[model samples]
Every structure is written in C-alpha cells, then in structure tokens.
Target: MSEENLRAAADAVLSRLVGDAGGTARLRVDQWRAVEALVVERRRTLVVQRTGWGKSAVYFVATALLRERGSGPTVIVSPLLALMRNQIDAAERAGIRARTINSANPEEWEAVRLEVASGEVDVLLVSPERLNNPDFRDGVLPELAATTGLLVVDEAHCISDWGHDFRPDYRRLRTMLADLPPGVPVLATTATANARVTADVAEQLGTGGDTPDALVLRGPLERESLSLGVLRLPDAAHRLAWLDGHLNELPGSGIVYTLTVAAAEEVAAFLRQRGHAVAAYTGRTENADREAAEADLLDNRVKALVATSALGMGFDKPDLGFVVHLGSPSSPIAYYQQVGRAGRGVEHADVLLLPGPEDEAIWRYFASLAFPAEEQVRRTLEVLAASDRPLSLPALEPLVELRRSRLETMLKVLDVDGAVRRVRGGWVATGAPWSYDRERYDWVARQREAEQRAMKEYAATAECRMEFLRRQLDDEGAAPCGRCDNCAGPRFTPEVDPAALEAARGELGRPGVEVEPRRMWPTGLPSVGLELKGRIPPGEQAAPGRALGRLSDIGWGNRLRPLLEQGAPDGRVPDDVADAVVAVLADWAKGPGGWASGRPEAPARPVGVVTVASRTRPLLVRSLGERIAAVGRIPLLGTVEYSDDAVDARVPRSNSAQRLRALHGALTVPGTLAEAIAGGGPVLLVDDFTETGWTLAVAARLLRRAGAEAVMPLVLAVRG
Candidate 1:
C-alpha cells in the first residue's frame, strides 16, 4: 500500500472511531483493507468477521472518507430497530450525520428523505423491509440508489435462503444493487455464514452481471472470552429449576433464551417470583415494551432478559456477561450468532445450553412453516394474474387455503422474485415468466435436515463445543478451544435446590390459559359464498373459555403434544391430563367470568356437557367429555354430530375465512341435543383442540340458537 493512502486511512479511523474518547486509534490490518477497498478502490467487499470485530467501524470510517472525497452520502440497509438505534448513536459519536427511516418513526421518513436528497445527511440507515414499500421503492429508493456513494448490507447472511436466518426482505436488496450507478462501492457484512451462504450472497451482489464479485474477507470465529458447555436435563421442570437456583451464580446480567414465547414469559415470571429481576422479550411483545426491556438490560437494572430470536442480530451490548439457552437452536450457525452476544467486551462470560428431549419436536414445529408447495404457489399466481385490479391480502384469503402469516410470507418471496409486485393498495401479478424452483427448494429442505442433525450431534458430542460450531460455519482455522467444558472440565453442575425444584413443579402444575373468543367475522367472507360480515351477533358469540395449556407451552405441552399429535391413535385421555382438566375446571368456577363465579353477573353453573363430535380422535374426545361430565355430575348431552352427508373441510392450517366457510353449515345440532339445551343453564362445549376458533364459534352459535343460555367452550390444547 502507498504511504499516502495508508496515512489517509489511519486518519479516517482516528477521526471517526477515536474522536474525543481520549484514546489512540489504530486500524486492524483487515479493517484497513476493507476500508481501502471501499473508499480508495470503490470495489465491492464482504466482511465475514466475528462479532465485536469492528464491522461497524469499517463502515463508519469508510463513510467518513467517502464523504470527505465529495461522494454522495452512504446508504446502509440495516436489519433491526435495535441495530439502527445503535448505529445512529455511534454515527453521532463519530461526527457523521445519520438519519434513519424505519417502522418505529414513520413520521420522520419524509423529513429524512428530504435531507438525504438535499445532501445534508452524511449517512442514511434503512431497514430491509422498507426497500419494497411501494412509496419508498418507487420514489425515495431510486434517487438514493442513483446518488449513494457507498452501499452497505448489514447481516448479509440473511440475503441467502441457505443462511440460518433467511429473510425475504433481505433479498430485495438485489434490486437496489442493480440500480446503483457504476463504481458505487458496496459492503456486505455478517458474522454467521457458511461457505454456501457466502457464495450465494456474493453471486447476488453481482446481479447486474458487469461488476466483479464482492471480495470476501473471513476471520477466525473463535471467541477467546467464552466458556461453552451443554447440560442435559431430564425435563422442562428440572431445567427451570436449574435456572431458578443458579441464575445469580452466572457472571453478570445477560440473556436467557427460550424456544417459544410462552416459555419466555413463564420463565421471566417465575424468576421474578423467586426474587430475581427479569423481563421477557418476544416478537409478540409491544414495541414500547420491547424497547423498555432492551434498555433495562443495557443498564443492568435486571438480572437477565428472557427472550427468543427477536433479541438477535446487531444488538450492541459490548459488556454482556452471559448467555443461556433453555433449548438448543436448530442450527449451530444460529447458535453461534446468539452466544456471540456474550463475551464481546467482558473478560469472561459463561455460555450454556440446556438441551431437552423436546428440542427436536419444537424444531419440527417451526420448520413445518417452510416454503409453500408448488401447487399453492401456482394457485396464487393464477389468482393474481386473472384479477383485473390489484387484490389485497384479505381478498386473496378466501380464495387461497393458506393461513394469513404463511400467505404473507409466500407473497413477499414472490415479490422479491419478480413474479408479483406490491403496490399501494394490494399485490398484483407482474406478468413475468416464473417457474417453481422445485429442485432448489428441495435442496434447501435437505440442507435444513442436515443442520438439524448437526445440532443434535453438537448437543451429544463430548468434543470442544466452540470448535464444533466454528467447523459448522466452515471456518478453516477451526481448532479445539481449551476453554469449553469438554476441553477442560464441566463448569456447571446439573443439580438444583429442592426448593427451586418444588417451585418449578408448582408453576408447571398450574394450568388454564384463557381462550378469547372471536368477535368480528373475517373480512371478505362474502367472496367465498358466505354472507357473514361485521361483528358476530352478541347472543350467538361464545363466551371466554379455558384451555389446559397451549401446545407450544413448555410445561403441560410436554405431556399433551404426544397425545394430541396428528394421527396419534384414538386412546383415552392420559391420567395426568385428566387431572389437569379437573384442576382447570375447579379454578375456572370461582374465577372471574366463570359460570359459577359468585358475582350476580356470572352465569349459572354449566347445566350439561356437550361434546363436539370429532371425525378424528373421537375416542379421546368422547372419553374426556364423558369423564368431565361424570366428575361434575352433569348430564351427558347428545353429541353435536356432523350429519352423515356434511362436507367437513377441517384443515388444521387455514385462514379464518376458509375455516369459517368450512364450518358454516356443515355441523348441525341434533334434535336430542336441542331438547337437552332447552333445559340448560349454560352449555359446556368441549373439543379436542382449537386452531382458528371458527369451529367453536360455529358450534356455539348452533347451541345459542337451540336456546342455551350461553356456550362456554373448553379444549385440551390451543394452537397459537
């Protein structure tokens, strides 16, 4: 390198990274190389370094240098709100003006865009999801792409479907990349990508087919300050007990990751009851609550933040002290990314995984929401192509069999592939030639299976855990890290205090999650030959009910899943579950809104037990209903049977409109059931499970019409 060029690069780093911090600034050789490539040569680059390795420093310094040379402001496509907040703060410290446009601050977007256009902003950070917004894509994005001096894609691994964290929004960056002017330097950075994901992203970076491929720079993946280990526990209660007893023994305040939102809330609540400060973080948490939780963790006001993957990706906590996983992640690359959050600035941090037998089942449940089948894809395309005008998501729900979330995900993928376009009001077909890449999707599925197997091996292996994770990422310099449990000796014991064990048992033994009834009928139901619209009739709507627990819960779910799984044989209800049902009923009676609640507004005790006939699991459903009625000394009313000729379209995974349509007139209350209902105070309608809740709604309406006072629906499990 020329001395003058080196001097300029050093100056950029000093001015931007070390300004007013009263410390000398020295660039790592690799960091300088990336800076030079972007600012000096204006070449595309990819940096695959571990967390806390100055990835942001490289980009901020490069932005400073490029702006000094009179190039347009740098545009960065970031992934998360937390990351964007961190970057905005860091940019201020570096003396570079930065503005952000994200979902949190929609009112500021226009002002930020105007600033960028007028060249008053030195750098602009955008969320990947904003790339395809109709207004932004058509208006602000094109101008920004044309004028940007440097383009940066943070968390670049997400751009490839093969990456552990695949996001359809990330792939939209290719369109922006193709529109950039020539010689506009690009930088893509991530800490978690195997060789395949790296190659896939690099190939996509050269989408215009003119510029050279992005230069790849990968460093060692080992974390010297981390001590990794796996502790095998017998069941969920034991794991919770371990956490309750030993949370304070860890190094400092950090994170405790759970596989499900239910588990996170339960763990956080349980720990708080045990006199430890904690809070839960999940996708379902409100934006304000999530922001508050993040801040509390950052300030060390809480012992830990119980969270899911929502806490991952670019959360800048340099001194985070420890990370514990309640269950194993499906992929080691993802595991590395999460644990990398710890030991970034601290001298030593503990990383532990409590692997349970239920991990595989949880993994399968999540993986089931994979890419849609080719038939669904083709059907969606046909529907879009035939429409005269754009159709909103609600318009398509009645025509498509997919659930809302799954449908939205499929549409986003198609949008990125050019087969569909998202406009102002709805989505429209682009009349573009598109075919199902069946082979590629199948390969990705196989790769996911392989990763699952690799994770299982990781939990069972006695070898160095850190080395195993590094090798999974195809790190060439992978070697045994002498700090992990297997490399040295076990650092954590599996034992839990007896009091803590009892506490976990008490928490798990408690049941009865309230099931809120659906009030308004889904939109566009008339499009499917149903006349239902607006709020459902108050007299016909089912009252709030109770379930033993959610199928995704870490407690009773451990027992209910095997019994309630699809195609499980028609066996009697298990003894434990029957006991839980008895307990839930007892608690429900005296509680608020219950039939036996002493309040004058409360309805009378349930007059009879009316079972919803199940084509599948009839034996179990009938057995449970008969058991409950027998215990409560109530009449066993006739079953609400679908007549011999009814069309039953009870798909477990369908949108509300389709579910309502399927159950609209397909079920009829038998004459004997109606006669019994006439004498009822309230009907206790029981079913095996409630997924969309339409079945319960329809059945409750039938009972109401049959002259029952009210319908209190109960179920064994609720699928969220």
Candidate 2:
C-alpha cells in the first residue's frame, strides 16, 4: 500500500476509535509514518513520541489494514492491567475484537485462548509476565507467534534493562521476537525512553532479522498540555497540607502520586478526612479494589486517587486535570512517564511535585532491591544445578539467602538468560553455561545513580521543568516548555491553609502501628540448622505487638528512622520521640485489640519490660525500655544479652533461614532476667527496631520457655 492509502485507512479507523467528537479523526504525519512502516513496508518499528501522541492508533490502524489483508491477530505485550483494559476498550471503539489474558482475569483465559485459536480475535492483550508463564511460554506462545500478523510491544522500554521501569519478564520477549517468522511486522511503543533505553529496545526489536532493521519514529518529548511545577515543602505533613488546601483548584479529577504504598494510604486517608472524595491505589491493593478505584477515577467520581508507581502506565483518562506528587520519583524518566498520565486529554493539567527530604532515603531503599551480588547469583545457579527435580520457590528459598521477592526476581532473570527454566512443578536448571554479567550489572547500577542525580537536578533546576525532563531523556529538541513553574512564573504557591496544616500535623503525629507476630515458621527452616516448620508452637510465639511507626510511614516513622538507623551513634532516645513511643503504648493498650482493652480475648497485661539486646544502639534501646517501664509503672526487667558471635549471626541482609540459624544460639536470656520472667504475666519486649522480626521472635521464645505467660513486642520502628 502507498502512504496515501495508509493515511486514508488510518484516518477511517481513527474516526471509529475516537467516535464522532469531530467528523473523522486523522492520524498525524508521524503516526502515519509508523503505520506505513508496519503495513506497507512490513518493517519493525519503535515509536518514542510524547504521551497522547496516539501511538496506539499507529498499531490499531495497522492491525485493521493488515487484517483487511487477511492477516492473523495482533498480539500486544502490555505491562499493566489498567493499560490492557484501556487498550481493549479502545480496540472495540475501532470495531476491532480484542481479548486479554492477564493475572487478573484467569477465568476468561481459556475462552480467550479458544477465540485466538479460532482466528476470531483481532487483538489480544497480555502482560509481560504472561509471556513467562510456564504453560503459555511452552505451549500457546509458539503457536501464537507463528500465525500472528502484527506484534505490538507497548511500553517497550521495559524490554531493556536500562529502562527506568525494566522488568526481568519483559526481556523474555527476545525469545519470541527471535522466533517470529520473517515478514511479520513488529511495533514497539513508549512515551518515555532515554537514548540508552531507546537504543537497547530498538536493537532487540530487530532481533533475529526476521524483518528489516527497526524504523525508529523518534519524536520530541514535551507535553505542552501539562503545566509542571515543583513545590518543595518542609516535610511530609506540610506537603499533605498543601494538597488538602489546593487539590480542588487544580482543574479536574487527577492522581496524587506518592513514593510508597504507606504514603499513598496515609495521604488518601488524610484527604478523605478533609472531605475529598479519593481512594488509594497501590501494588498492595486487591484486584477488585484497584478496578473500582480506576473506574471511580475515570468517571470523575473521585477528586483523585492517591497512587504509587503501580498506577503509572495504561490508565487512560485524556481529560485528567491534575497530577500532584507527594514526593518525587528517583528518576526524571520515571517522573515524566507518571506526569504524562495527566494533561493527555486536556488542554491544561496541573503537575506539581512536592519533593520531601525523605525522597532520597526512599530511593536508596528501592535501589537496594535491585540485582543481588554475583556470589548470590552463583550460589543460586549451583544449587539449581545440583537439584534432581524442579524446586518450588519455597524449597529453593531456604537454600538461597535471598528474600522471597528478590528470589523470584533473580529466578526470572535466570530464566531469561537460559540458566534456568520454570516448569509445572517449579524451577529447574537448564544446564546452560552462563557467565555472570558483572559489567552489565555494574553499568546499570551506575546508570541508576546517574538518574538519581538527574532527578535531584530536576527538582533543583530553575529552568523549565518539562524541558529539564526532556533533556534528561536526551531529546536534542528540548527547549523551554514555556509551561513549567519557572517559565510560567509559579502558577501555584506553597502557602498552605493553617487549619489543614494543623489537621495534617495531628494526623501524622498520632501514631500506633500493629506489629503482627509471625505465626508460622518460614518454609524450609530445617534446611538450615533448625528443626522448625509449620505453625509455630503457640506457647513459643510472641503476642501481637505495637510499633510507633514503619520506616516508610509518612508520620512518626519519618521522625524515628534516623535515630534508629543502623550506624547511628548510641545515645539516649530524644524526649519527643520517647514520648511518641509512650503514646503508642498507651493507645495499643486501650485500643480495640489491646491487652488492656479488657476483652476476653486480650492477653494478660504486660507485667514487666525486657529490652532486647542491641549492639548498634544499646543506649537508645535501654533508655526506651526504661521510659516505657517508668510510665507503665512496671518493673524494668534486665536487657537480654547477646552471645559473642551474635554480631555475625544477626546479619540484616540474610533471608529468614540464615537469619534464624544465626539467631538460634546467639541470643541468651540472662539467668537473672529469666528468673524475673518465671511465673510472670505478659511482659513488654522492647527493641529499637525489628527488620525481620527474628530478633523479637527468638527473644520471645526464650522468655516463653523461661515461664512468661505471654510476650508482647514493642519497638520504636518497624523496618518495612
């Protein structure tokens, strides 16, 4: 087909996709270029245009033209559920049949698969994770790959480890791409990709040379509809106050992006208290709840949905009016993608980022969750190689020292590298020779550090905010956006309502978080030197406890984290923080689930206090215990002692099995403290912080064995 014919076909489909807003919507020159490359030339392509540039239209239009030519269905590898839903709806608007198979809709998968096999579906949407499913990867994918007409990888930047939001599962697409039959045109699209990420993704899109080299349709990255700004508040509370005061003035319903799930919930709750109709959306939110939240936001029933990065991509509300960040993301690319969500459908949308002091701490914590050291990678491979059968994550977890989340991530990477394969039962070694990619991993780490610095510069830069972000993406055309805080002369002010500020302060200052005791022993504990498994013996368990806050909590947690930090100098607890702990204890005792609630289910009131031994902040721990004991009018039982080897045993980074093994004999209940505990009531077990809860669990067991009726653990902070 000629470019004229492609443009005509694309315009007709675009009319149906957009439906009568104007008589017939026409594709722009670049959108037509992407469509022409895919349909006429049948070339692989990558579209890196700004948000709202109709990248979807390029593929949907191509799918229509190709299907008119009797091509098989277009298979899209989408990243988020919300994205899939939006694309499916858009496909139907264009009169194209679309089906989806994602983690959320497993029940409909068989029906969708049957439709696909029968050639009844025009477009099939799936998550990147679905590409890694054992059955699908081994069974459905090959068949789907063979007969597919067009392959669309939405959010293609994820295919590159260098992308801001890279996922190990996404890289698995390379296999399918390599296997794709020649002449099956492929298209990858993203609104946010830097030069490095764009290069990597384009290279992969042209993998196996099934088609001509990728025709890259790179465009400027500037959202003129978005008016960007950064409001640097003094603290989390003041930021909340700013939102409470100014949210309604920011045009239409929008998203309030937060740095953490806890912060999202906290801000959502605070906003609701201020009488704003809002909901919190996070990765932790249930599928049904997330769906409802999305629906509410779409219909403008809520002013905003407090969200983390979970709501980043695939949410389509073209008329979204505003986006406020409680804290800035670590990367400018990531920030651009999120802020892109707004102003896509509207002429002008407010984009305000409230950068807090805690942003760096949050970034560092997430950075720590990336690829583990090579030693861990090597040991994981060796363990898999020695196994006779596939090992489930539970069984494999004990053999490796990585946490469950980290372990799963590592396994995904190994699967993509051909060093491992996930089968029906679990994961198995493929016996593939895999050289550790130390250089690649180090390079990615360095890139992340660079991105972090870039993000800091973004917040601090006096130049146009959008221009700053575009420059970070290596867009040579970047210039003054003329719509940012700096260029537009401060469209928003930092002044917050006094009443709202006080309310925010009160909400944040009020503190008490439940520390649910670990009930069952971690899986494969016996794989270590311990003989524990299944439900923990009730008598040996610690009672449900309390903490002043979680390290990620936007309230007291932000205040307490520094003092309880690992290497902080040993000093007595500050009077104000000590008072907060006392307040938490008071609330926990009298609260609904408290031992002092006088309910029949409540445990006997803690009769005394026993402080956990801490090597790093002994003074802080002892002082907190003394304060609690003095306030409660209970005896200050002696601090538990750590054996000589406890330091090595209490490795903070180890998994549950290794940590428990180290703690097994390293903790000793002082004979004197044990005597005090004998025949006693529930006692308050105090600690500066609990990372894995192993310390509290081990100490509680010893106290229980010694004769305490119950042990209630309390701490200044709970490490998230």
Candidate 3:
C-alpha cells in the first residue's frame, strides 16, 4: 500500500472508531494524527506522552483500521501484566474479541495460536519475555505475522538499561520480530523520558539516523498535591513509630518499600500490631499470595501494602496516596519507581524517604552484587559464544552451573555488567567479555561507580531533592522541586555558637579524667607471663602482660589488639629491646584520650581464652581492665583490658568485638563508660558500621537496662 492509501485508511478508521460516532469513543484528535503517522511513516516511531494521553486509543484505532483493510492481527507487547488484563478487559467492554496468553495454561496456547492464524483475533497483548520464546515466535508469531496488521511496544523506556525500570528482555523485541515482513511499522510509547530514554528508544527501534522523526511529548513531572518529606532516624523502632503515626493520616492506599523480606514482613506485622489494615509481599511470597495482595490493593480491600522491589512492576493501582521507604533505596531510579506508584491516577501523592545508615549499606551491597567480576564476565561470554543459539536453563547449566532459580539473577548481573545482551533467541555475548585494558574497564566500571556515587550524593545532597533526582537522570536545566527534603532540612537548624564550643571543651578537660579503651573481653582475655614460658599454654601465647602494658602506654593499644591474635608463645623481643619491655608497655598504655575514643570497636563475641591447663570456656566482655583511679589529666588512650579473673584462667576474645559491645552499651546508657568520666556527663556509644540499626538498638536497650543515664549512638557509616 502507498503512503496516500495508508493515510486514507487511517483517517477512515479514526472516523469509524472515534470521529463523531455516538457515545464515548476511544481516540482523541491528536491520537488520529499519531495513528496516521505511525501507519505511513517508514521508520520506527516513538510517541511520548503523559498518562491518559490516549496512546492506547491511537494504537487500537490504527490497528482496527489496518486489520479491516486486510492487515493481520496487531501484536501489542506490554511489560505490565495488569495493564494487559485491563486492555483485554477494555476490549471486552467494547465487544471486541481479544485473548491473553501467559504462563498459566499450556493446553489453550494452541487454541490461541490457531485463532491468531485464522484471523479470529485482532489484538493480542503479550509480555516481552513471552514474545522472545522460540515456541511462541516459531509456532504462534509466524502464523500471526502473516496477517498481522502492526506491532506496538508499550512502556518502551524499559528497553533502556538507563531507564528506571529497565527490562533486559524488552531489548529482544527488535530481533523477535526480525522475520516479520518489512514496513509493519513499530510504535513505541512511554509516559516520561529524559534525552537518554528518547535516544535509547530510537536506537532500539533501528531509527537512530540523523534527524529521526520521533514524537517526544512531555508534560509536567511535578505533582503539586504531593507533599514530600525525609527523615534521618537513628533506629527502626523510632522509624516504626513515625510510620504508625503518619500512616493513620495518609489517605487512599499507600505502599511501604523495605529492603529485605524480613523487613517487609516485620513492617506488615508491626502495622497489624498497631491496627492498620496491611499486607506484605516479597520475592519469596507464593505467586497466589502475591496475586491476592495485588487484587486487594486494586479492590481497595487493603489500606496499605509493604513490599520489596519485586512487587512494583505489572501493578497499576492509580489512587495511591503515598509511598514510604522503610529504609533507603539503592538508587534514585529505584526510589522514583517506588514512589511513582503513588499519584498515578490521582491529582497528587506524597513520598517519604526515611534513611538512617542501613539504607546506604543496602545500596552498596546491591552495587557489589550487580557488578560482576572480570572472570565472571569472561565465563559468561565464553558460554554464550560457544552456544549455537541463545541458550536457557538446563542447556546452559554446565557452563554457568547456575541453578534454575539463580539463572535469571546471574544473567541480570551479567546484563548490568554490560557483558551480555538479550537477543531474539536467547542471551548473546555483546562484546569481548574480559578486557585487561584499564581504560575499557575503567569506562565500563564508571557506569556503576557513577551510580554508586549518585547514591552517596543523594544522602549528602543539600540541593532541592527533586532537582538532584533529575540531574541523576542526566536531565539538565531542571527546575527546583520545591516540595523535597532539601527544601525542608533548613527549616530547623539553629546558628552555631563558637563560644559555646570553647566553654564546652574547657569544662570537659578535667583532671583525673581519662578516656580508656573500652575493654572488649574483660573477663576472658588470654594472658601470658614469664611463668608460663615453657608450657606453651593451651592457646598460642608469647606476648606478656608487660609487653601489652608497654604497647598500651605508648599509644599503641589499638594496634596491639589485632597483633595479639598472632601472638606466639616464644618470648621474642626486638634485639634492641633486651630490657625495654617495661618502658614499651608503659608508653603504649599512654595513648591519646581523644584519638582512642574515635577508634571503632567491634562487637564482643564468644571466644576461648587460652590458659596453661586448657582453653577457657566461651565468654563475652569488653577489654579486660583493672579498676584504675581517676588519675591525672593525661587521658587513657585505647581501652585497657582488665578483669577480676587471673590472666592464667580466663579465655581471650577479640578486642574489636568487645569494643563494639561497649560502644553499644555506652550509647544505650550514657555516663557509664570511661568517656563519660572524662566528659563529666552522659556517655556516647560509637561504631564503625551501622546498616539496619538493630545492633544499635540492642546496645541501647542493654545500656538503659544496666542503669546508664543516657546512651548516644554514633557510627562512621550509615545506609539509607
């Protein structure tokens, strides 16, 4: 058919399906133009519009017109299962024949295929993964293609890994339809896109030539009705309290995204405990249970749903009032998708991101998981290159040794690693997998490194959160989103007073105040002296208490602990230190008080300390210490290990663990540790890493119960 004839047919179809025909018609005026353009344009095309932009109407109208003019059934591939169902339901509402093929039925697939082959179906909604299947493409698609009218790919942004919801399978649509007759014309649609997404669509559609004809319609991304808020809580209990309080005020339906399945369940249970009607879903949930949860959300039977990222796609409930991140998300892209669920069909929605330390760790872990080792990349490529066609499951098992359940995960990791591509038949190695070239690795590594930096940047960003998010998408010239966290953080800070700092420091530096290293295993630390030299004590031992004392005196207490792990029973001293052991111990013991406090303490663990007779039983405690008088303004450096037990009888534990426990206890109960004695008030708890805040909470409780007046927890690293 010539372009003139195609335009004429599209116009006729628009008139019959939408034009002044009786009741409500599907297509809008602009949709008619798009349909005509899609039919007549030789190159693949994109139609970018906001939600409710009559995109579906245009596709159907054009499809109906073409099918009536002897074109075959129009194949519409969708990423959303719910959207597909809705589309089919809408077709049924219009008295049009439509059917959906999914993983549910094997027997009926043949019938569906026959119907398409016999021209009994005009439109078929399928998933990208399903379309790429050989059985579907070979057995059904070929038959459907003979008379197929047109091809439509929805939620087209998913084809881009740069997209917020990238699906590797979406990239296969190009090859899946490779055998189709030329000029079938592919129509791609999406709600929002940056220049990257737009360019990605063009490239994937084979329309990347200069001055490509692509319709990039855009509307405001701002939702005025949405009130965004962010909170940086120290612990989950506090966060849970906040969640409970706000959940009561939130309207319509809401979603709570958690990083782990346990967290999802915990939040759901906590909400139920507080009398909020809530349900939970995660990757581990059975499909039936997942379906029920989704149905409840759609029917408004459940007021709230707590879930992981697994529950976001293929779901479309438009009246979501708000979305709350129980913890921080790994990236802004993920954050956007989870929060985007709200205000979908409504005028506005609210999103709250509650980050502490754990959320950051979650993102870091994900980054690590997604980044495949160079060897992993090479192995994946070797397997793909050795295969005749795209291989799946059992066929590729010997190569990757990946279990069926783990196959997709491994493939996805490789996908993000940019080592492989999803092709028409299966996965194919995209480029030479392993590169010793530092430049190439560095370039590829930057993609992920940049994203990780973005995660960190989001945490530290003081700019408008909305603008920051847009910048992350590489969208430039973005206007400030006035209703974000950055706009709100400034509302509460008071001016700093330098005089106050001076007064505070002067008052804190008191005599007889020393900040000792919080002993990790006070009761179980293994000890050695000249007395046990020939016995080779139950556990390896060479360092004497004098050596430890000397090291502690010289500000080496922190370093001495780790070295203790490698202690040998042989009394070996430096050749220059024939009689300097005493001086060394004393000097080591004199570490700087301020520096000692800054050191991170690992948690006290069950460890056996060796004695002359045997290894002592498992015991837990901070560094062993002998109660010393509050002596001199010369503050103690690291935690001094002292316990009532004799060095010969007690079992030793790791110093870091002991310090961690002490830190927890100090945070939980202030004015209890050596620091408090120096500071002259409440004690402070400190740790090196804090992800979920659970350990901190436990520490706080222990300290409080132990009669500490106040506990302040501090950590070096915190996640979302």
Q: Rank order by lDDT, top first?
A: 1, 2, 3
In candidate 1, what are the lDDT values of residues 220-243, reduced to their tens digit?
988999999999988889999999
Tell me each candidate's RMSD, in Å, in order. Answer: 1.4, 1.5, 16.5
Per-residue C-alpha lDDT of model 3 across residues 1-720, encoded as one tens digit per residue: 765676555555544443335443434456656776666563356776544455676787677666666777778888755577667765554445777777645577778877877779888878777755657756676666655678888888888766656676676675545555666667888765666677878676763334344554444444454556666654555566667666766778888888877567756876786678889988778767877888888888888889988766546666788888877666665565567668767876777777754554445445544434456446657878876678654445434422333456557545545666555656877664444344644554466566667766776777777777666654556677677757744321122234433432222211111212221222211221111112322122111122222111111221222233223232222222222222322332343322133334321210111111112211111112101111112222222122334233121121222233333322222333334333232233433223334344444344334433433343222321
TM agreement with the true structure for every prediction = 0.98, 0.98, 0.59
| Model 1: colliding residue pairs | none
- Score candidate 1 by lDDT: 0.90
The true-versus-predicted C-alpha distance at residue 537 of model 3, in Å, is 40
lDDT of each: 0.90, 0.89, 0.54
| Model 2 Cα lDDT, one tens digit per residue, 468-521 | 888899998889988888997899888999999999999999878888898888
Off by over 4 Å in 2: 1-3, 21-23, 644-647
Query: Highest lDDT among the candidates is held by which one?
Result: 1
